[model samples]
Every structure is written in C-alpha cells, then in structure tokens.
Target: MRTTKLPTIELSLVTLRSIQKKDFKDFFEFGKDKETTEFLTWGPFKTLKDAKTMLKYIYFKRQQRNEPIGYAIVSKETSKMIGTIEYHTFNHKGNSCEIGYVLHKDYWKKGIMTEALQKVTQIGFEVLDLDKLVIKHLRENIGSKKVILKNGYKLVAIYEKQHFHTKTGQYHDVFVYEHWKK
Candidate 1:
C-alpha cells in the first residue's frame, strides 16, 4: 500500500484544504439545508450536534488514515467553508478513485463548483497520480451532470435503482461518469 497526503489546492475563487474544527458552523449551515443535501447520501443535519458528530467522524478518519479522504471547500474572499469535495473511495491497484462534492445552495450555478471540480480532478490525476477518476450523480441532478460533462467526464453507465433516496424513500437511477488520464 502507498500513503498519500491531501495537498492544499488553491483556485481563483476557492481553496480546498483539510476540514478543521473551526469549520463546524459553516459545515452545519450547508449540511442542514435540505436543498443542499438533496442529492447527497447523507445530510440535512437536524441539529448542530449532528453536524459536530459528523465533523468529528471526518476528523477521526483523517487522523487514523494515511491520507485525507475529504476537504473543506472555502471561499477565498470570506474565508468561510461553502462546501466539501473528496475522494471518497480509492483503488490503489487500479490507480483510480471516485470523487464527490457538495456546495451551499446559495453558491449553486455560479461556476464555483465547476472550478472546484476541475482543480480536484487535476489533483486526482496529477498530484495523486491516479489513472482514472469516476463520479456519479442522481439522474435528476442536471447541475451535477453539467459539471461532470463540462469537466470532460463521459457518461459511462446508468444503473437502475442504484441509490436509495432518504428524502423520497425510494430508489433512483444513477448516472456514472468517468475521466481517464490522457
């Protein structure tokens, strides 16, 4: 096994760095928003304690693992956490990983996520030396589809009933996208 570290990534509008305890408030802000957590697997935090517990788990994983699994997406101007992006899954043997992210609803469709995704994918390929990167979004998440396509990820597959939606209490199809290092 190879150990890797998450490098701080700076972009024109945002900075991607390790999540910190100080970011709990911002984390809660987005995590508690139903619209923000709509397409995500977990969230819509019921209370500050819920947010704190989740943040603690993230930090705990970082402490125990050899590399970071997630990052806080901070706005450069306000220095506030507006989102999170992460390589949630890794396959060392295949040199590949699956990436995921979420942004505050207020920041949606503003190109912030597009910029962040571009930078993070670059990190996955250039910094982490990954041969391939994958991302999946609910079929209804057109915004995510656009971001994925804009970043040059190709639609590889659509799995039926691939995800269980907590809010809807039903299964939904998922669109899988992929980018291969050239």
Candidate 2:
C-alpha cells in the first residue's frame, strides 16, 4: 500500500489538517452530542478520555500501520476541529478507496463539507493519482446523500442492511457511490 502523509488543506470555510493532541477539546465540543453522531458508526464521547484515546489512534497508530489516513476538518472562522474527512478501507490493488466524513451538528446545512470534498477529490485523483474514489452513506442520511451528489459521485450500488448503525440501533441500507478520475 502507498503510505500517506496528510497535508493541510485550506478551503474557504475550513482547513483540513492532521490531528493533534490539543484538538481533543474541539472534538469533544460536538462529539458529546448524540444527535450529532446519530447516523455515524462511532462517538458521542462521554469524557475527555474517550476523545483522547480516539485521537491517539488517529494521530499515531494509523501512521505506524501505513493505513490510509485522513485530515481533521478545522474551521478557519473558529479555528477549531469541527469534524473530519478521510480516505479509509483502502484497496490499493484496485486503485480505489472509500471517503468518509462527519461535521459538527452546528455547522450542518452549510456548503463547508461540499467545498472540502471537492478539494479532497482533486487530491485523491491528482496528488494520489488514483483511478477513482468511492463513498457510502446510510439510506436515511439525506444530508450525506446530498453531499455525495454535490461532489459528483454517482450511484453504483445498493445493499440491503449493509451496515448496522450502532448510533441509531438498527440496520440500514447503504448507498454506494463512485466518482472516477476525470
């Protein structure tokens, strides 16, 4: 697999940078909210310890393993980490990988994620020189669906009850979308 070193990505509203130890407090800001994590697979952190442990893994362990890492989405306006966007579950042999993101509930409905994804898409296709990108979202996550569409991903497949959403305590169908290098 190709190892990655994340760069600081500056967008109009947010900056995508590496996770740092001190950013735990910013993550805790919205991470403690159940509603914010309602559609995701992890987090609604109850304590700083939880945030700390997760940050440690993102900051340290993934690098050691040469896993495909991601950027922490920090707001330029507030200078705080409000969410993250990353390439995960890499399939190097196929030259494709999945993209995922989460934003603080307070910043939802704005065009922040859409802008961030556009740049990431450029990096994925040009910097990384990958053939395509993949993304998935739960069937009920209309917000996520919108972001995926806005970023120019097209519906490629659907699976019945693909992911068991621990946040919502139920199985949910998943929509798989792909955007090839253009």
Candidate 3:
C-alpha cells in the first residue's frame, strides 16, 4: 500500500483541500440547517463558535489517527464545502470500516455523494487495502438508503429500533449495509 501524505488520498473537488479549518463556517451553516441535520447523529449547532470547537475535536482525531479522518465534499464551481463523508470505526486487521456521510439539503439528489463515495471507496480498497465497508441509515431516511444502494453496498443487517432520533429523542429502526472489495 502506498502510505503517502494526506494530499495523496485527498479527493478532487474543484479547488479545495480534503478538509480544512477555513471550511468550518460553511460546514456549520450546512449542518445547522434542519433539513441537513435531521438524519445526522450530531447537531443543530447553536452557534458557529460551537461548530469551531467541534472542528477542533475533529482535527485532534485526525492528528491521532494520522489518516484522512474525513473529506469535505466540495463544489468546483463555487469552491465551497457542500457536505462530508468519513470512516471512523475501523478494524484494521479485518480490513473493514464503518462509513458515514451527510450533505447540505440543497445538494441532495445531485449525485454528489454517489460520486464522492465511489472515489472514497476506491481509495479505501485500492489504496488503504480495506476489504469491507459498511454503511447504516435510518430506515425512514429513504434518500440515504438509496445512496448506499446506489453506491453498490448490499443490505446486510437491520437494527431494530436502533437509531436515536437526534431531534425527537425517539428510537427508530436502521438499515445496515455492507460492501466488500473482493
């Protein structure tokens, strides 16, 4: 495997880096939008400063892992961060990882995530040598489930009432999907 610098694994999106501190404001704005945050595990940011604090935490994790923690899905035309996709729970020896993604509601249905996941999954398999990738989505989130299926991930499991509604404080069923590169 070619273990190169961050730039080597960075996805192309017009003119932006994979993830940057300067992108915090845009990330905050997108994440705070109700439509965008509805399916996310995190928040409706009360403030940008809160978002910055979260960004700091994200950077800390990246430093510790010495890996590309995540990528800010960006737009080439406007050079803005539109969303993000990441792998967090990695089992190195198993060659497996859990994936997560979210985009600004405005960017949904544009196939932005499909393209980004294709590139990222290629990297996870070809470059990182991961054999399997798993993605999960709330069962009610039809759009997210579609994204996973469209990306070639296969339905593997369904967690009964396993998703915690970030807004409603209710538990819901979630569908777990997996893809292997073999």
Candidate 4:
C-alpha cells in the first residue's frame, strides 16, 4: 500500500520532492557515475535509455498517478537534483520498510545524506506511522555506516556475501540495521 500523500520533506539545505520528468538530465548526471555507484547494488547507468527506463518504471509512473514511491533531493542553492532517497521496500503487515538512497559524488562528505536521512526517518515515523525502519549498507561503505548510525539506526547483523555488486562483479558482506519508532 502507498501513503495517500506523497512525502515532501523540507530542510535547510535541500527539499525532498517527487522526482519529475524535468529532472531527467540531472538524474542521469549522478546515476551514470561509476565511482558514485561503487558500493551500490545497482547502476553506473550507461545510456540515456537506461536512465529513462529507470526513471519511468521506478519513479515517474507512480508519481504521475499521484503516489510517488521515492523523492528527488534537490539542492536549495543550485536547485539541481543531487540524489534520491526513499523507503524502497514496504511491509504493511509488519509496519516497517527498508530505506535506500544515493547521492552525487561531489556531495559526499558534506553531511547531506545525514540531513536527508533525518527527515526521511521523521516521515517514516510521523507520516507513515511505521513501527520500525530498516536500512542496510555494504560493510566497506563507512559513509553509509555513518549516515545510518547518525540517524539512530542500530546494527542488527552482518550477513556474509549478501549482496552481489554489479559493478564489482563480486559478492560483499552487508550490514543490516533497524530504527524502532520512538
């Protein structure tokens, strides 16, 4: 099930809004970076076709129907799409979901994800009324670790070879975490 009102989180640095068709080029800008997608399970998007397919199937279709599945993190200063974040996996029966996100390489180490995550966490608890929120990160990704932990997500497990990274062509251990609504 989807929320009746698609979330629109406002923050000092960025505004999390529904991804738009006008953001196509900006989306491609970050999605196509091999370095940016290094630890991610998906994307170093090769072609505009790949970008369009992903944007349409994953974001646009739902957005057009008025229930956006995710958000585009638009920078306030430049007003450009810098990243995407959302509860990618939903479990209404359990009242929990998995959060996922990606940011432009240039924006890394700027505390952007942490700020965005704080807002998303608020939405999961306050807006969605979810009982808990789950998140995962590649063990090697210290950046993800920091963001997850900074938002009060607790480490639950380290599953061995849990993810097959397409870019690396190898399996890597994954760390699972959860944030109980409090």
Which tens-of-lDDT digit does each residue in 85-127 have in candidate 2?
A: 8877768789888888889989998898899899888888877
Which model scores highest in lDDT? 1
- In order of listing, the candidates' clash counts read 0, 0, 0, 0
What's the residue-level lDDT of 80 in candidate 2?
89
* Candidate 1 ranges beyond 4 A from true positions: 1-3
- In model 3, pairs of residues that clash are none
lDDT by residue (tens digit), candidate 1, 1-182: 24467788888788989788878889999999999999998889988888888878865475566556578999998999999988867676788889999999888988989988998888888877889999999999999999999999999999999899989999999999999998
RMSD per candidate (Å) reads 1.7, 1.7, 2.4, 2.1
Model 3: residue 37 alpha-carbon error in angstroms = 1.0
- What is candidate 2's local distance difference test score? 0.83
CA lDDT of every candidate? 0.86, 0.83, 0.76, 0.84
Give the per-residue lDDT digits (tens) of candidate 3, residues 93-166.
78688888888888788777777777777777877677899898888889888778888999988989887786
Q: How do all models score by TM-score?
A: 0.92, 0.92, 0.89, 0.91
Please state the error at residue 14 of candidate 4 in Å. 1.4
User: Could you tell me the TM-score of candidate 4?
Assistant: 0.91
Please identify model 2 stretches exceeding 4 Å from their true place: 1-3
Query: Can you write out model 4's per-residue Cα lDDT over 1-182, one digit (the tens) per residue?
Result: 34636567788788999777778788888989988888777688888777778888976665554443688999999999999997766676787888889999998998889999998888888887789899998888999999999989999999999898876788999999999998
lDDT of 1: 0.86
Model 1 lowest lDDT segment of ten: 59-68
